[model samples]
Target: MTGVSRLDDPMPDSPSQTTPIPPVDGVLTMFYYNDLQAAADWYHRVLGFEKILIAEGLVLFRIHEGSQLALVGKGYGSQQPLAGTNKGAILSIQTRALQQWHERIASHEAEGIGHELHRGGNGRTVEFKVRDPEGYTIEFFEWVE
Candidate 1:
């Protein structure tokens, strides 16, 4: 008989074992705006996000599959006002397509939105910073693989 170690024994599978993780559904972002209507319009027209829900100065948009973006009216205390401005909070949005996202933001800038778009470190991502009508800053980014 050839010498063999118990360590070479075949492992048995268990019912508790699981494989193949599920993909992430989506992401959600919330923004506190003084004017929900303006925020909704900006996101819809400028960012190409479709409005999914709106109620009493609160608006929610479907930014992507299973992802939502929200605009909440002021006085909710979720955000603080910016220094010397009536707006508050900074929002960052991420995407996988940099060029396409940048073009969209650029179009908004061309319309005199007063926002700036720049390339991030290592040129792997492009970011656009825009202030809402209420002075809150929103940063949109597209990550390069």
Candidate 2:
């Protein structure tokens, strides 16, 4: 045989390569509601979220620093059990001022209709749950430690 290297042989001096992963900046939570306008208004009033963008049947809001809350119009075949109910899925909001956050949510008359406050898993966070007009539950909390 001739003194030549095989074509299918792996290279010994080449470094291993890896695929680059994309960085996650933040999360955008989507909630489906039958009445998009009503749901948007309710979230705006309750969570102090301002409308960032409004499309055909969707409304996007900037809830906090890096988080976004999107309200999608229902009846587009994306229905879930929690779509028109307020008992499923817990949306959490993290804050630095627990007491102030609690006070602000507690002071709302609309919150009094369905808002409940409790201690978190570690006992270092205070959480409050409230429902929007479309019957979607949202949980807001602040870290005490």
Candidate 3:
């Protein structure tokens, strides 16, 4: 990952740059799936995530412009189980073409439409929720301008 070290590095910080030290640029939600290969394929096909690399039992994917998702085989690697069920944390992604994504996801499983395309978040966004192959929630939103 690219970084600038700190707001107070060796030299003086530049004003032309955005935030001195961005609280957080991107997020990589890593998880362990029962079958890494199948999980990778499902994410690639259904969720439209491209595989960046796969070695041993781990798989990395680019979920969006700034976010990523990494998956590992359950028994193939060492990792403490993440808490909660398939309905645990939601992976929210901002989209420019909500309608297109809606159609694509709905085609796979109509029931994945948990929130039934609606305008929410103080009417500032149009979004919907869907479950992945293993039941984790994935939310897609389009900012309302």
| Top candidate by TM-score | 3
Assess every candidate by TM-score: 0.59, 0.69, 0.69
Per-residue alpha-carbon lDDT of candidate 2 for residues 25-94, written as tens digits (9 for 90 to 100): 9888887777788878877876678899999878899977778988888664365425445445657777
Q: Which candidate model has the greater TM-score, 1 or 2?
A: 2
In the order shown, the candidates' Cα RMSDs to the true structure are 10.9, 13.3, 7.9
Model 2 pairs in collision: none
How do the candidates rank by TM-score, highest first?
3, 2, 1
Candidate whose lDDT is highest: 3
Q: Write the per-residue lDDT of candidate 3 for residues 63-130, one digit (tens) a residue.
A: 87768898878766567435445545677888898889998888777346853689977777899987
Could you arrange the candidates by lDDT from highest to lowest? 3, 2, 1
In model 2, the worst 10-residue window by lDDT is: 11-20
Model 2: residues with Cα > 4 Å off, grouped in runs: 1-21, 80-87, 111-117, 122-124
Enumerate clash totals for all models, in the order shown.
0, 0, 0
Candidate 2 has a TM-score of: 0.69
TM for candidate 1 is: 0.59
- Candidate 1 overall Cα lDDT vs. reference? 0.66
Q: Decide which is better by TM-score, 1 or 3.
A: 3
